[model samples]
Target: MTKWKAVIFGFILAVMVKSFFAQYEFVGLLIVGFITGYLAHDGAIGGMWNAAVAGALGTIVCAILFIIIATLGGSLFGIFGGLTGFTLSGITSITVIIGYLIYYAIVMGITGAFGGALASKK
Candidate 1:
């Protein structure tokens, strides 16, 4: 498959896994990584780079979806009170979430690269 196909597959797979198994969301990333790497290998491309790109794309898509959901839920539930209150706690929460997302993406990318390396060896 092409790189775009791999990216789309990874994104959908990640989203589905995350939605169905919230507790084991990392598994979704791992699966995406593996699939992307395998596809890259089959395509005779740079397996590591392609897999990493797929991982990044999948993670980014998932993060954006989560952010949208969180924003809507917060607005509907009025979880943060007023803007003033949100300014403080919200900043911290957002920062933490962003940090976690970045870390998650990096880890997933590394995992993808590993999978790509394994595939290339075969």
Candidate 2:
């Protein structure tokens, strides 16, 4: 498979695993890196690179989605309570997301390289 296609497949599988392991934040993300690497089918370096990209993208997407969902839920709560939607503005700051993105990218990159080595051997 092409590199992008492998990354897409890896990302999809990572989401599924993440959904199941949602309660364990670090574990979920680490598993995502492994899944991305295994499915990458691009040998060591490629798998590592693809998994890192997928992991970074996943972190960003999940953060945004979480914020959106929280906002919607807040809106619903506000409607029932006759209050305006409470903002989670502080948590949604770009700086926070960037910090998380960097952390995840680093963790996933190293973990993914390990996974990629395993994949290439198999």
**Highest TM-score among the candidates is held by which one?**
2
Per residue, candidate 1 scores C-alpha lDDT tens digits across 12-35 of 776676667778777766777677
lDDT of all predictions:
0.61, 0.66
Clashing pairs in 2: none
Q: Whole-model lDDT, candidate 2?
A: 0.66
lDDT of 2 by residue, 1-122 (tens): 33787567656655554456667767776776776777675666776788777767766776767666555666445443322332436445667778877876766666677677788885
Residue 111 error, candidate 2, Å: 1.9
For model 1 the local lDDT of residue 36 reads 69
Task: Name the top lDDT candidate.
Answer: 2
Candidate 1: list runs displaced more than 4 Å. Answer: 42-45, 75-90
Alpha-carbon RMSD to native, per candidate:
4.0, 3.7
